[model samples]
Target: MGAAYEGLSEKTRTRRFLASVLHLTETMLDHLVDDVDGVDHVALALVGVGDDRVGVPTAIAR
Candidate 1:
């Protein structure tokens, strides 16, 4: 999430977050992660596929 957040453009981040969010603290990330309860909510991480079968997450959805 740190990587993804850093990758977000300033405009994109502001529009998505509805504010001028410079960055998310580790505590904030933890809260975001913990907010998902399997029964009610979930997050999906999208990644590129490669022949080596290793990839970095490109996007995530909640």
Candidate 2:
């Protein structure tokens, strides 16, 4: 998840998170990942294979 967020372009991050920064502090990330009730809002990542394996966040939805 952190890797995916770091991989995002600044413009993409800003658009998705409504912030000017490309990265969030660990504390902020933890807060975002916390679940409420039985539900959790999340960003789904698609990971590649082998030595090139990397995560890319594809969607964020409730």
In candidate 1, stretches whose alpha carbon ends up further than 4 angstroms from where it belongs are 1-9, 22-31
lDDT of each candidate versus the true structure? 0.86, 0.69
Q: For residues 1-62, what per-residue lDDT tens digits would candidate 2 score against the true structure? A: 88898898888888877878766788877777865344445454454455656555555554
State the local distance difference test value for candidate 1: 0.86
TM-scores for every candidate against the unseen true structure: 0.53, 0.50
Task: Summing lDDT over every window of 10 consecutive residues in candidate 2, give the lowest-scoring window.
Answer: 36-45
RMSD of 2: 6.1
Give the winner by lDDT: 1
lDDT at residue 62 of model 2 (Cα atoms): 43
Global Cα RMSD, each model: 3.7, 6.1
Error of 2 at 45 (Å): 13
